[model samples]
Structure formats: C-alpha cells, structure tokens
Target chain A: MAVVTSRRGRRTAAPYAFLAPAVLLFSLFILLPVGYTAYLSLRKVQVKGLGLGRGARSEVFAGLENYQRAIADSQLWSGALRVLLYGLLLLPIMLGLALLFALLLDRPRVGLRRFSRISIFMPYAVPAVIASMLWGFLYLPAMSPLNYVLDKLGLPEPNLLSPGSVLFSIVNIAVWGGVGFNMIILYTSLRAISPEIYESARIDGCSELQIALRIKIPLLIPAIVMTTVFSLIVTVQVFSEPLTVRSLTTSVTSTWTPLMKVYRDAFAADDLYSAAATSILLAAITLVLSFGFLRFVQRRAFGEDR
Target chain B: MTSTPARRPRPAFLPTAILLIGAVYCLLPVAWVVAASTKAGSTLFTSFTFAPSGSFFDNMGDLSDYGGGIYWRWMINTALYAGLGAALSAGLSGLSGYTLAKYRFTGRSVIFNVLLAGVLVPGIVLAIPQYLMLAKVGLTNTYWSVLLPSIVSPYGIYLARIYAAAAVPDTVVEAARVDGASEFRIFRTVALPMMVPGMITVFLVQFVAIWNNFLLPFIMLADDKKFPVTLGLYTLLNRGATEPALYSLVITGALLSMIPLVAVFLALQRYWRVDLLSGAVKA
Candidate 1:
C-alpha cells in the first residue's frame, strides 16, 4: 500500500487541506447555528408608533429579558417536569429490558435468539414520526385490534390517550422504539467479554442468575452508562413522536415537550426571541444533565480505586 | 472441564417465552400496518384489524393518485436527501476524521473537541436559528437547506476517526510519505481503499439519521415538491385525521416507508457496530 518511501517531501499544508471541508461545514452548520441561537436569545423586537409603517418594529438587544421570561415560563417548567417524569419512566425499563434481553440472548440455551434480536431491533429503523403514527392508530379505540380483542373477550377498554395516561403512552412508544438499540449495545459488549470469565464463575459453583448478578451486570456498568447518557440526550430532544401523535389526538398540546415548545414559540406563536431563549436554556440544562451523569459515573468508576 | 455441577438445568421455555412476548409487542404495530393497509377504505375500520382485504393494490393506487402521485415524489425526495446528504457527510467525515487521526497539527484537539461538543447540542433546537439564517441568504425552502446542515455529522466524524485510526496504520502512511507520494495521493489512493469499510459504516449511519430527520426538513422546506417522506407522511396523516378515507392511505404510506429502511437494516445487520453507541469507537 505504501509506494512513496521518502518522508522529507511531505507538505505541512496537507492535514489542514484535508480538514477544510469538515471545518467549513462544521462552522457553517453546527457552530454558526449555535452562535446564532445564542445571539437571538439576547435580543427582542421593539414596536413603536402604532407599529404599522416601515421600521415600525426594530430589532434590539434586550440583555437577558428573554432569558428572564424563559426562566419564569410555566409551560416550560411543566414541560421540563413532564420530560423528567417521562425520562424516569423510560430510562429504567428501557435499559432494564435491554439488559435482560441481552443477557437472555447471551445464555447458552436461549431459543429463537436471532429472530427475537432482529425483531426487537427492527423498530430502530422505523423513524420516530412513523413509529408514533403506527402506534397512534393502534392506540385509537375504534382502530385498535387490541381493543377489538378485549371487547370480544368481554374486557374493559382503557383509554391510553387520556390526559392522565398520555405521557405514559408517549413513554411506551419511546421504549418500544429505543429498546432494540440499547439491547444491541449491551449485547455487543456482553459478547466481547471473555467466556473464560464466565467459565471461572461456573467453576466456582455460580448459577446463571448468580453469575449474571455478580459478574455480568457489574462488568456492564460502562456500557450501561453510555446507553443511559445517550438515552438522556435523545429523550430530551423528543419531538417527532408527540408531535405526530398530537395530530391524531387533541390531548397533546403544542408545548408537549420542551422542543415542542421551542417549535410552537418560534413558528406557531411567532415569538422567535422567546423561542431562542427557551431553546438556549433547554440546551444548557441538557448539557448540565449529561455532563453531570458523566461526572457521577466517572467519580464512582475512578475514585473508588484510589 | 466441569469444576462443579452447581448451575441449574437450563430452562429454555421461560427465556424463549419472554423474548417471544417482547417480539410480539415490538411487531404488533407493524403487523397492524400491514393488515390495515390491505383493507379497503369502506372496510378499514369495519373489518378486523389483522384481517386482510383485497384493497392493498387499490389503496396504493389512491395514494399514487392523491396530489398527482405526490407520495412517490416524496419518496424520491427522501432518497435524494438521505442518499446525497449521507454521501457528502461520509466524504467530509472521512477526510476530517483521517486528518484528525493521522496528523499532528496545531489546535487539532481543540477543533476536534469543538466538533465533538456539536453532538451534545440538541440539533432540533438549532432548526429555528438555521431556518432564520438560511432565510437571510434566501436559501430556506430549498433542497440545500435540508441537505447542507445534515452533512456536518459530529458523530460520524467521531466514528470515522476511530475507523481511520484502526484501519489505516501509521506505518503505511509514513512509508507512503517517505516514498514521496503527495499527501493527497496517499490519502486518495493508498488510504482511501482501506477506509472504504469505515466510510460505508458512516454512510449507513448517516443514511438512517438523514432518513429519520423530520425537524430539519420540516423547518427548511415550504414546498411539497421538496418534502421528504417523513414530512410528507406527516402532512398526509394530518389531513387523514379529518378525512378518514385517507387513513388507509396514511397507513399504507407508513408501511411503505418502512420497507426501504427495514431492507437496509436487515441486509447490513453485520456492519452496524453498535459499539458506537457504547462510546467504544476507539476500535
């Protein structure tokens, strides 16, 4: 593969040249949007003199007024708290099920392992909007086969779309869509662990459950943390599911999630400045939460050995 | 090899039963979509949810005729966005990742970290600002608006860097440099073939991502002509709420959308290094 044998002729401009496309794209798309969002967060439009003619509303720096409004916004807080609950509901069961499935698949005698793994992971391919739409139809009483079966069996129908239960409805879709990816991550990591470790546990008279409890789960901490952090990031940005499901049912508000609020404020309500502030604030909270999780894991993982 | 006979006899039924239950739960909606799409508009809700009718072809015909076959146009638009976007993203990620991995340059770590931080920023939050910025340049409502933002994939770059470090050995690069091959030639020729598998991995990852992207295209495009399938189906589903007749079409469209993606997922099952999810991309 190596034809050239002389290193002296290498140019200093090479690496930068290679990186120019990424640098340009990163600056234009990623960095610029962030900076623009931050810049918009601090400014508001001033309307004066009946606000009718040219220059009636002038854009001007508000110096954190939008931020103050965002901080006090009740809808934003409810949305945050709602997501907090949703995240709590989602992360544990999703990860726990994922861990369970991964462990089950790793076991020696698990049947239909390949089929179950593929079927479980298949939803990862279904986009969130599509997944929600599919589930939305199923949640509709008239359209739902589950409801049909229940009625045939003389069972009571529960409203999954009620205001009280709608959040859990959303969480179910998330778990359904998310479990497979997490399962695969856990399964992959589990596969990479040396079988010799399991052999030793077996030789020490450890049962399968005992070995799993004492060895596999403990060794899976790093992978589990990774999945948790990723889940945290994805859940906070939840948009498509609720947004799509809202159309089928009137129960979902425009500000269902914080991202939904950002969308509603920006487009629906025509309040770009407030939306900017809200998004920036949401972004900050997300950063803090993710970084805090990382730090918590790091402290426990590293500090204990000392 | 047995040191002890302490482990209980393997009970296959319990594990198999649990997994099958999970599988059924996972596949239920999918089965419904397939079953629902087969019913005629009149018979859709009137029939069993899983019962098949002879209207599958008829529903496809209606979806095709609706908006003068705009559904197919959405499918085409989706292909363009996901395919072209992922291709460009893979190219940029490959080049940038290769540079970051192989070269010792000033400010490299800083630049890489800055890009890495891009992954943490909720991309959906940036959609509005991106929309406004593109509006300034009169670029929103265009294909470039959706395609452009997607090309800068921080995660792809991170994955690509890992792939490059593993696939392209430094010794080969040094030998090529010593042989007086131009750096671009070494990269384009010697190193690129080695990076193809990695590039394809990035391509597949970015492909699914861009395929699933709803917010970017939702905010960017105002024209139905430019809508991806996700947004297209969204618009259809919104209309379907009032027009129950359109439910069959929406259901049909939803089923169709999964076909391409599921095919890809199944065919490339082996290539998906979920280790990317585990933050162990250093391979």
Candidate 2:
C-alpha cells in the first residue's frame, strides 16, 4: 500500500515537475512584469521638500490619477490615432496582397511556384529594423532609384519622406516585410484543404477564379481571421519600423505611435509611472481588440458557435 | 498545337505574372542592397542606385576596421543570444508541451490558458516593467535580462503542445511505462526524439525571433559590447545621420547581418512549417 501510494503520488507530481520550469519562467517574466506594471501604474512619486535628498520623494497611491492623465494626454490620443490610420492603410493592402499571392501560388499549374514562394517568404528572415532601414535608403530621394528614374524621365520627384506621405512609405515597408509571412500562413492553410472539393467545383464548370472566390476564400475565413487578429495585435504595437525609419526622416515623431509614446515616456522622459499607465491601457486595448475580434468572427463564421 | 482536346488549357500566364511580381517586389530591396553595399560613401549618392561599384571589398574592409571590430562582436552576441535562447526555449516548450499534452492534472487548464493569454500581451507593456524589475535587482544591463525573458514563449508552447499531441502516441508511452521506465527517462529517450521535428520548428521560430528582436535588448543592454546586430546597426544608422561616410559601413553591416538568418531559413526550409503554426496538418 505504501509503495502503491508513493508511485501514484510520484506520477501525479511528475507533470508539475516537468512543467515547473515553464511555469516559473512565465511567472517571472510575463506575469511578474504585468503585475509590476499594474502596481506601478497606480503609484506616483510624491516629491517632499524640493525632492533633493533620499526619502524626499516617496511612492504613494495615486488613485487613478495616472490613468486619468494618460487618458487626457493629447499625445497619447494622437499616437493612438496615428496607429489607427497605420492599421487602416496597412491591413487591407497587406492582407490583400498576401491573399492574392497565396491564391496565385495555390493555383494549378502555377509557374515558378518554388521561386515565388521562397522569394516572398525570404523577408520573414530579415528583421523589421533592417527591412525598414533598407527601405529607408530606397525612399531617400538623393539615392532612391524611383527618384532617379523620375528625374531622368524629366518628371517631378515626389518626396517619400515628406510628412504627408511618410506614413504611406512606412506602410510600404510593412507590407513588404509582412505580406510574405501572412501569405505563407494562408497558403499553408489552403493546402490543408482536400483536393476533392476543388475537383467537384471544377467539374461543375466553375472557372479557377470562381473556385477561388467562391470556395477557397469562404473556407479560408478561419485562417484569415486568425492572421487578421495576429496582424492586428502586431500593428497595435508598431514600434521598430517607424522607430528605425525615424532615423532617415522627420515625419515619424518621437511619439508617432502609442507604443512609441510609452517608450518615450518610460525611457526618454523618465516618467515610469505614466508610461506604466499608458502601457497598461495599451495592453487592455490589445486584449479587448483581439478577443473581441476573435469572438465576433467566431460568431459570424460558426453561426453563434453552437 | 498538339494539345489534347479533353484537357482545357489553364491560363497560367496571369498567375505566373502576379507571383513573379511579388517575387520581384520582395527581392528588389535585397538586390538594391547587394548593389548599394558595393558603392563608396563619396559616390553612393552620386552613382545610379542599381549600378555596382568596385569598392565592395573596400567597404567590407572599412566595416571590419570600424570601431575596433565591434561589428563582429555584435554578430557573435546575436548568434549566442539566438542560439542559446532558442535552444533553452525549445527545451522548455518541449517539456511543458509534452506534460500538458500527455497528462491531465490539477490546474492544467488554468495554466495553459494563462500562458496562451501571454501571447496577446504586447512586448512593450512587459518590457517596461521587466526593465523596472530588473533595475531594482541590479540586473537590467546584464545578458540574463534579455535571455531570461526570451525563454518563455507562449506561442512556442502552444505549438509544441499541438505537436506533442499529434506526434507522440499514448501506446508508446504506455509501453514504456509498463517497462518500469521513469517519466523523465521515457521523455528523454523516446518522446523527445519523436518531437524533434516540432522542436526544430520551435527552435527556428525562436531563433529568428531572438535574432531579429531589438526592443528587449534595446531596453535591457546599454553596453555597446552587449548590443545585438540589430541594435548595433541601429546605432550605426543613427550615427550615419551625422556622418554620411558611415552609411557604407551600415549598409554592409545590414547585408552581413542578414546572411546567417537567410541561410538558416533556407537550410531548414522543409522543417520551417507554417502548417504547424496555425494548428493545421496537411491532408
């Protein structure tokens, strides 16, 4: 009985032991940071007696002051609006190109399928920083081939880094970096679909475009939703691309996006309290958007998930 | 002219053209860099963009000779961070995934759900608190500050769990259990081998992620010696804003930094499965 009890106990405890490392790491990194952020967001340093000596400034509970300030901060609102505009421009075009390329590659008798797939997916290997840098140079009018060609043709050279169009330039870099990965995911999901479905659709005298539009896309709704949510989550936290491109241009401000604002607050302005509050808000927005979007799509796609 | 009547001619032209266009669009910048990296700083702006110059070796020499060979240090640091971080992360994911997939225990669902939720939390949100916490502990500038946080990947665990469930059969584990083998022993000797393909996928994903990651190291390490290639290159680019001469070195560094990752991706192209990423199995 002792041996049997010990054996069963060991078996039960084995899983926890196996999972201990991940649980510990996750707690220390993800849970701890989030909890710390929450704690910091609610606390403010009260400067006592000119704030010159130790203990002169002490952390005190601010009772939603930081949150209120963050909400009222026009810079944060502008940053959020900028990210929204970025997503608005980035999503449809990126996903559209991804879907188009995916469908084209999935088509029967497609030429250079391997080359196209590998070439398109190659950018996934390049870091966003590098991708932006490369595109940054290409957008520089002095060295840009686009401007060079335009100038040679006696046409006006449009400034890509101008404040009015820098957003579009940033959008182009993201599309270049992103379309490939999204295309791969969508394409992989497409390949999971059995060929017999397509065969029947073909036998019914439907053209390839009809099959693609009517059958392939409808079945791809789940995968599309997944990619869209992933992209949305990523877009909400747009940091490195604009940050990197900011080196070459003046349009992308120090607070061009919400996360950038958080970064500036935390690092540049040394306002950890406000940065913590803004980041918490950003995290909340991300969770709400992703979950809300997922639930919304799930309901529509599966007819109320019954 | 000799095509069979029963087979309808597929208009492969448009699809081919469209895919080729994508390929060209994707490859264009890379091609430009390959050409641009060859030009000298004096002529980089003066010359046509695509025109290659003979200063390629000179530019590479300058990149190497810049800042007492610090560029190579960044390269080595990137390799170490990515290689070690990914390996550790893959191992943890494998173990946790196997445990979650093979066994049901107390708080299992809750644990899995919490970790899955970690996937949606933006890095910047966590990055700030992580920095603060590490700062409190005097570890903010250490290598551990970056490597420690990178090892716990919720998406990796999710993928590993799916892979473990699909790949490892209950009977094999049961058979090993019937032989009086310990759980860890069986995992090490039997289950781990079966999970190799999935683990490789996890490793490559984590590898690319840590390699390409800038924000964590950017926030963590202030030491130039500890900077990864991404941060190092960014600093170089920032300096290039003032000294245009450094642009050649920055361009060369960017090109050089990409080679390892592109090589790794291509070599492991077969195992780099997106099907597993989205929880789909090819039919």
Candidate 3:
C-alpha cells in the first residue's frame, strides 16, 4: 500500500513538473505584461512643486481619463480609419487572388503545377521589410520597369510613391507578399477534400468550374473565415511594411498606423501612460473584431460553437 | 481499388494561364531583387530594371566592407536569435503539450484556455509593456528582451498539444509504465521519438516566425551590433535616404539575408503544409 500510494503521488505531480517551464515563461511574458499594461493605462503622472527633481514627478491614478483622451485623439481616429480603409482594400483583392490561384492550382491536369505552386508560395519566405523595400524601389519611377514600358508605349507614367498613390503601392506590396501564403493555406485545405467527391460530381455531369463554385467554395468557408480573421488582425497592426516604405517616400507618416502611433507615443513622445491606453484600446478592438467575427461566422455557417 | 480506367485528362489552358500569371506576379519582385543587387550604385537608378550588371561581387564586397561588416553580425545575431529561441521554445512546447495531452490534471483546461487567449492579444499591446517592464529591470536592450518574449509561443504549444494527442498513444505509455520506467525517462525515450516529426514542424514554424519578427527587435534593441537582419536593413534603408549610394547596399543586404531562409524553406519544403490545428498533412 505504501509503494502504490508513492507511485500515485509521483504520477500526480508529473504533469506540473513538465509544465513548469512553459507556465513560468507564459506568466512572465504574457500575463505580467498584459496586467501591467492595464495598470499603466489607468494611471497618470503628477507633477509636484517646481517639477524639477526625482520625487517631483510621480504616478497617480486617473480612472478612465486616458481612455477618454484616446477616444478623442483625432490622430488615432484618423489612423484607425486609415487602417479600416487599408483592410477594406486589401482583404477582398488579396483573398480573391489567393482563392483564384488555389482553385487554378487544384485544377485537373494543370500545366506547370509544381512550378506555379512553388513560385507563388515563395514570397512567404521573404520578410515584410525586404518585401516592402523591394517593392518600394520597383515603385520608383526612375527604376520601375512599368514606367519604362509605359514610356516606350507613349503612355503617361504613374508616380507610385506620390501621396495620392502610395496607399495603392502599399496595397500592391502587401498583395504580393500575402497572396502566396493565403493561397497555400487555401490550397492545402482544398487538397484535404477527398477526390471521390470530385469524381462523383464529375460523373454527375458537373464541370470543373461548377464543382469548384458549388462544392469547393462552400466547403472552404471555415478556412476562408480563419484566413480572413488572421488577415484582419495582421492588417490592423500594419507596422513593418509601411514603416519600411516610409524611408523611401514622404507619404507614410510617423504615425501611419495605430500600432505606429503606440510606438510614437511610448518612445518618441515619452507618453507611456497614453501609449498604454492606446495599446489596450487597440487590443480590445482586435479581440472584439476577431472573436466577433468568429462567433458570427460560426453561427451562420456551422450553427454551433467551434 | 476501383476498376475505373485511368485516363489522362487534356491539359487545362485557362486555369494554367491564370496560375502562370500569379506565378509571374509573385516571382517578379524576387527576380528584380536578384537583378538590382548586382548593379553598381551609380547606375542603380539608371539601369533598366531586370538588367543584370557585372558589379555583383563588387556590391557584395561593399556590403562586406560597410561598417566593419556589421551585416554579417546582424546575420549571425538573427541566426542565433532564431535558432536558439526556436529550439528552447520547441522543447518547452513539447514537454507542456505532451503533459497536457496525456495527463488528467487539475486546472488543465483553464491553463490551456489562458494560453490560447495569449494568441489573440495583439503584439503591439505586449511589445509596449514588455519594453517598459524590461526597462524597469534594466534589461531593455539586452538579447533577452527579444529572445525571452519569443520563447513562449502560444501557437507552437497549441500545435504541439494537437500533435501529442494524435501521435502519442496511451497504450505505449502504459506499457512503458508497467516496465517500471520513470515518468521523465518514459517521456524522453518512449513518447519523444514519436513526437519528433511534429516537433520538427513546430521548430521550423517558430524559427521562421522569430527570424521574420521585426516589431520586437525593432522596439527592443538600439545597438546596431545586436540588430537582426530585418532591423539592420531597415536602418540602412533609412540612411539611404541621405546617401543614395547605400540603397545599393540595402538592396544587396536584403538579397543576402534571404538566402539562408530560402535554402531552409526549400530543404524543408515537405513540412511547410502541416496543418497546425490538426497535426496532419494529406500529402
């Protein structure tokens, strides 16, 4: 009985022993930081007499004041609206191309399937910084092959980096980098479908396009929802691409995106309190958007909780 | 097998054309970078895009000579960060995921749910407070600031949990236990081997993620010596604004930085399509 009890005790502690490191790391990094952000967001700085020395400045609690300020900040609202615009422009076009390419690749007897798949998915390996930089130069009128070809054709050249068109240029860079990854995801899911289903559909006199439209697209909704949510979260952040492009042109501002605004407020403006508030706001919006989207899609598509 | 005839279908023209167009759109930038990296600084803007030049080695030499070869330092730093960070992350994820999947323990679902919640939090929210917290401890600019945050990947652990549940069987563990194997020993010898393929997928995914991470390193490290390739190239591009000559170097550096990743991607091509949630690859 003593031996059996000892063995049972050891078994009980085994999982915690294995999980110790992950739990510790998660607490230190994820849990602590989020709690600290919430704490900082509720606090404001108080300046004492003369405001000149170490103890002269101190943190004081200001309930919801920072949130109020964040709500009223025109720059942040504008940044949010701009990101909304960017997402509106980016999601449909990028996901459209991804779905198109994925369907084409999954087509029967498709030529150059391997080459096309590899070439299309290759950009997933390139970092956003590099992708933006590469496309930034390509958008340069003097160095652009597009402009050169237009010149030869006696057509007017478009200035891709100009303020009026820089957003479109950014969109192009994003599409170039993102379409391949999304295509691969969609294609992988497409490949998961049993071929027997397709064969039966074909035997029923359905064309390939009709099968894709009727069967494949309908079955791909869950994957499409997932990709859409992930892309939304990423697109809202919108940091590296625009940050990289800002070096090449003046169109992208220091606070081009909400995340960039958080950076500016935290480091440049030395406003950690407000930055913390903005960070919390952005995170709240992200969570709401993602979970809201997931719930809506799940209810509509599956009629049950995932 | 069914007794249906295996007839060869005719090649589809329209589908192939659309796929080819996508291939071109995706490959055009990579092709441009390969060509642009070879041009001399003076003619970088003047030369026709996609025209290869003889200054390939010269541009590389200039990149090598720039700032006492800090580009190589950035490369090593990136490799170290990605390599070591991903290794440690994979190990932790494997242990925790295996334990979570196999053991019936108190507070298990709560813990897993909390960790999954970490995945939904925007990185900016974490990055800002992490920077401040690190600063409070006087470790903001250290290698740890970046590597520590990267180590606890929720997504990796999630994948690992799914893999362990699928790959590691209870009967094998029961057999090992009956043989009087210690828990850790049973895990190391009996279960870990089965989890290796899944762990490799986790390792590769985390590796690329850490390598391609820009915001964390950008926010944390101010020292040029410690900057990863992404941040380093970004700064070089910023400087290129003042001196157009450095644009060629940025171009060269970008091209050089992609080689290791592209090589790894090609070598491990089979693992790229592993579905993290299901831990299955139809291929």
Candidate 4:
C-alpha cells in the first residue's frame, strides 16, 4: 500500500513541477496586473495647496467616486454608444459574409476557391495599425481612385474621413481585416462534417442550397457563437484603428473609444487615478457584456456546449 | 438530411461576384498604397491617383534618409520583439502543455481555469498596471518591458494543451519511462518531436499577435528609436497631417512593413491548422 501510494504521488507531482513555470508567469504578468488594476481603481490622488512639491501629493481611498464620475462622463458614455453602433454595423455583415464564403468554398463547383480564400485571409496577416494606415491613405481625397472617378463623372466626392463617415470607414477596415480568419475557422469546421451526411441529402433529391440552409447552417451554430463572442470582445477594445485614424484626421477626438479615453487620461493628461478608475469601469462593462452575451446565446441556442 | 425538389443548376455568378467584391474591397487599400508610394512629394495629391510614377526608388531613399534611418531601426525593433517573444512563448507553452496533457496532476483543472480566465481580461486594463509595476522595478521604456509581458500568453498555452492532448499519447511516455529515461529526457526526445506541428502553430499565432500588437509598445516605450513600425508609422502619420510631403514616406513605409508578413503567411500557411472550436466542443 505504501509503495502504491508513493508511486501515485510521484505521477501527480511531475505534472505540477512542469506546470510551475507557466503558473508563475501567468500569476506575475496576468493575474497580478488585473488585481493591481482593481486595487488602483478605488484610490484617488489628493493634492494640497498649489500642488507644488512631492509631499504635497498623496494617495487617498475614494470608494466609488471614480466610478460615479466615469459613469457620468458624457464623452465616455458616448464613446461606448459609438462602439455599440460600430459593433452593430460590423458583426452581422462580417459574420454573414464569412459564413457565405465558407459555405461557397465547401461547395464542389466553385472555381478559384483557393485563390479567394488566401486573398481574403491575407488581410488578417496585416496589423491593425498598418491596415488603418493603408485604408487611411485610400480615404484621402487627393490620393483616392474613387474620388478621381467621381471627378471624372461630374459627381460630388464623398469624404470618408469626415465626421459623418468616419465610423463606417473604421468599420470597413475592421471587417476587411477580420472576415477571412472567421471564414477559415468556419470552413474548417464545415470540412470536418462527414461527406456522407451531404451525400445522403443529394441522394434524397435535395438541392445544394436546400442542403446548406438546413444542414450546414444548423451545424455551424457553435462556430458562429464562438466567433461572435470573440468579435464582441475585440470590438469593445477598439483602440488601434481609431488611434491610427486620429493621426490622419481631426474628426477623431482624444477620447474616441473607452480604452482610448483611458489611455489619454492616464498618459496624456497625467491623471493616473481617474484613468485607472475608468479602465476598471471599462473592464467591468466588457466582462458583463461578453459573459452576458454568452449566457443568453447558450440559453437560447448553443445549449450543448455549456 | 432533408429532401427537396430538384432545381436547375444556378450559374456560378452570385457567389463569385460577392467574393470578388470582398476581395477587391480588401485589395483596394493595398493597391492604393503601392501606387501612391511611387509618386514624388506633392505629386502624391497633384497627379492621378492610380497613375504610375518614376519616384519609387527615390522615395525609398528619402524614407531611409529621414532621421538617420530611424525607420529601419523601427523595423528591426519590431522583428526583435515579435521574433524573440514568440519563440520563448512557444517553448514555455510546449513544456507546460505536454505536462498537463500526459501527467495526471492534482490542481490541473484549477490552473487551466485560471489561465482561461486570463484570456477574458482585456489587454488595456493589463497594460496600465503592468507599466506601473515595471516602472517600479526601473525597467520601463526598455526591451524587457515589452518582451517580458508578452511571454506569458494564455491563448497560446490553451492551444498547446489542446494540441498535446490530441497528438501525444501516455503509452509512449510510459515506454520511455520504463527505459530508464528521466522525465525531462522523455519530454525532450520523445514528446518534443510529436509536439512540433502544434508548437509551430502556436509560434505563428504568437508571432502575428506580438508583431501586430500596438498598445503594449505604445505604453511601454517613449523613445522614437525603440518604436515598432506600427507606432513609427503612427507618428509619421501624425506629422504627415502637418507636412503633406511626409505622405509619400508614410505610404512607402506602409508598403515596406507589409512585405515580411506576406512572406511569412505564404511560407507558413501549411502548418496553420487551427481547431479552436473542436477544443471548445470537447471541453
């Protein structure tokens, strides 16, 4: 009995020893940072007369003041609202196109499938900053072929970077960079379905479109759910595109997105306490929104995964 | 499978048309950058948008000459950060994942759950606190500031675990153990080879994530010499708004930044079999 127990202990111990490095690194880099941010969010900086010297400033505990302020800030709320609109525009169009392309690629008769897949997935390799830079140049009136064509056709050239059109421009960039990767993900899952499933449908005299609508779409619910959640998380943290676009036009303000506001407050304005608080708020909203979406979807449709 | 009435074959027009439209949308910006990079200063706005010009080499010379070739420094810095960071991340993930998959351990589920939770934390919230902690250690604005934080990727570890579970078998480990090999030896000689394909996938994913990352470097470093191409082009664009002549350099630099990634994607596509959904399904 002693020998057997010792051997069992040894077997269990090896895995933990190997996992120690990953556990330690995750604790230091990820876990600790999250805890530290939450802690910092509850504090405030107190400045004494004229704020002249080092001793004049001190940290004080200000429970929920920062949260209230963040909640009340019109700019931050509007930024969140703007992102909601952007997500509404982006999620359905991008995911719809991805599913369509994936289904098309799965069909046997489609020509240039490989070329289209690679070309579409090519943008995922490009960084968001570079993507925005490239798209930004194309948006420039003097540098755009669309504007040149409009001039030739005697039509008014619409400004893509203007206040009214900047959101759509940003959404277009996000969709272009994202759609292909999602398509590949869905396509891989689609390929994994046994061919016999589709063959039986064909033997029963079902058209390809009918087979896809009934079988393929129902089978792709899990992939769609996963992609939707991931896209939601990414869209909430929409910082790089707007930040890059800010460099191109004055229409983008210092506080264009919630994360960008946090950056500006912390780095540009030197308001670390408020920035920390705002970031905590943003993080909370993201957690609630993502998990909420997951719960809702799981309850309604993706019941098997949970 | 449901049965339906037979129908005539539709022309391969609608799907082809929609896909071509998307491809053109994706390609338009890239095409514009390539065409715009050829024009000389001020000709960027003055000439026809897509017309070819003769100043491509001259613009490259001008970008190289700008600020003592700081653009090249940015490029090298990006390569260092992405290359070294991804390599270290892949190594760590491989070891940890193999252990988790093959060995039956106490607290294994707890550790994995914690790591998965790390995935849900948005990166910005982590960046601010990480900067503060690094600053306390007097390591801010240094290479380690970016490299150290990037080494521990939750998603990489998660993928590695999935790969190891699917690819490696416990029977092989027992065979090696019976042959008097140490645990590390078995891992190195027996397990590592089996895990290569998975490690390569992790490496590519981490490489792209780190290379394309902007927020970490944005907050970690302030010096222009330490800037990655993403941040460098950002500053260039900011200044371009003031000096229209800088547009050509920005366009040229954007085109140049894309070459390495395109080469990597084309070369590495074979190893990029991602089964993230399958893992989720199994769990």
Compute each candidate's TM-score over C-alphas: 0.94, 0.95, 0.94, 0.94
CA displacement after TM-score superposition, residue B143 of candidate 3 (Å): 1.5
Ranking by lDDT: 2, 3, 1, 4
Docking class of 4: medium
For DockQ, candidate 2 versus 3, the one ahead is: 2
After superposition, which runs of candidate 3 have C-alpha atoms over 4 Å from their true positions? A1-7, A292-306, B1-9, B271-273, B277-283
Total backbone collisions, model 2 = 0
lDDT per residue for candidate 3 within A214-264, as digits (tens), equals 999998887788788878888988899989999999989988889999999
Which is the winner by lDDT between candidate 2 and candidate 4? 2
Candidate 2 backbone collisions, by pair: none
* Candidate 2 regions with alpha-carbon error over 4 angstroms: A1-7, A292-306, B1-11
Cα lDDT tens digits, model 2, A1-306, are 122223466678788899999999999999999999999999999999899988999999998999999999999999899889999999999999999999998888777788999999999999999999999999999999999999999999999999999989999999999999999999998998998999988889999999999999999988888889999999999999999999998888999998888889999999999999999999999999898654553354323224
Best-performing candidate as measured by TM-score: 2
List candidate 4 segments past 4 Å from native: A1-10, A292-306, B1-11, B276-283
User: For model 3, what share of native contacts is present?
Assistant: 0.72
State the DockQ, from 0 to 1, for candidate 2. Answer: 0.60
Interface RMSD of each: 5.5, 4.1, 4.2, 4.4
Candidate that beats the other on TM-score, 2 or 4, i.e. the better one: 2
RMSD of each candidate relative to the true structure = 4.1, 3.2, 3.3, 3.8
Ranking by DockQ: 2, 3, 1, 4
